[model samples]
Target: MTTRDALQTQLEQGIAALGLHLPADAVPRLLDYQALLERWNAAYNLTAVRDPAEMVTRHLLDSLAILPYVQGRTLADLGTGPGLPGIVLAIAAPGREILLVDSNGKKVRFLREAIRALKLDGVRAVQSRVEDVEGQYDCVTARAFASLADMLGWGGHLLAPDGIWLAMKGKRPDDELAGIPAGFGLRGTHELAVPGLSAERHLLVLGHA
Candidate 1:
């Protein structure tokens, strides 16, 4: 199979099995992101997932796994290093507004290029600290940003009063949960069984209960 074909197969089985729908069109968009990541990594160090196939499973599939639980018309990806769940979700969801925020200028530059190259609609790349952005979002999704407490402390102001926080973690984050800020309540948690890869994944939802 071609490299893209293999990755698509993996995404189909892995993500679809989890009830996450990634259509055929998403494959090329992901391929475009992988290619851009590779090109930018030479200068910006976008992501560590070097091989394209690995990018499909580890980066693309892992990001798309959160689709089922992401219920929002607008989302802010805090500390979106090279745009994980944010950019991928932008492509998958189409009409949703996605704002990818990062402190690093190079990564934001790469994200902007990826957005343009992929022709993603309703997506914006903001080069600023998470705390610096002044806007409300229906949801704030992040992958490997910081501790759950820190994430709430920094991105809490950006979330609308009714907004939810979708934080992705590897393994159950007991310590981080224990460190959650006083007011932000934990609504629920979902253990994601990603296909074609062996890794523990969890999504924590925080909101006013």
Candidate 2:
């Protein structure tokens, strides 16, 4: 298989399974982003998934799994290290204005390069703590290592009154459910089926209570 066929086919199959409608160029551009990330990983150590095939499953497909939950015309990805769902979302579904926020200088550097290399328009990266981030967005996303309460506590204000928050979590975060602060209420909990990925994944949908 050619380089494209090797992982691109896998990604295409995964996308098909997820039933996401992406642009014709979306798959190619997604692979381009993956290649760029692989190159940067050697020096910057952007992500831990070192194997390219694993990258396709864990990074690209994992991000695309939540496309259905994303809403509105604008998005901000909090603690977007190397632009996981933000960059992936920008490629798969363009037109929305995107902000990728990360406190790590190295990851931000990789993100800026990915933006330019991918020619991802309407996407910007800012190096700031989520709480320090300014402006509101129609949608907000976070891949959780933090509990629901802490994540919302830091970036809750960034969500517009009518907006949705797509919080990606591994396994069901039942323990953290009760910790969801007062203002935000759980909208839905989705069990994500990621092709070739065995890890449990869930997307917590939250909105203003």
Candidate with the greatest lDDT versus the true structure: 2
CA error at residue 185 for candidate 1, angstroms: 0.3
Tens-digit lDDT string for candidate 1 (1-209): 98667766776676667776666687677777877887788777778778877877888888888888888788999988998989888877788888999999888888898889899889999999888898999999989789998889888988888999999999989887788888889999999877667889999999854
Clashing pairs in 1: none
TM-score against native, each model = 0.94, 0.98
RMSD of each: 1.5, 0.8
What stretches of model 2 exceed 4 Å from their correct place? none
In angstroms, give how far residue 120 of model 1 lies from its true place.
1.3
- Kindly list the per-residue Cα lDDT of model 2 for residues 47-156, writing each as its tens digit: 98899899999999999999988889999999899898999999988999999999999999999999998899999999999999989999999997478999899999
Ten-residue stretch with the least lDDT total in model 2 = 143-152
What TM-score would you give candidate 2 relative to the actual structure? Answer: 0.98
* Residue-level error in angstroms, candidate 1, position 162: 1.3
Off by over 4 Å in 1: none
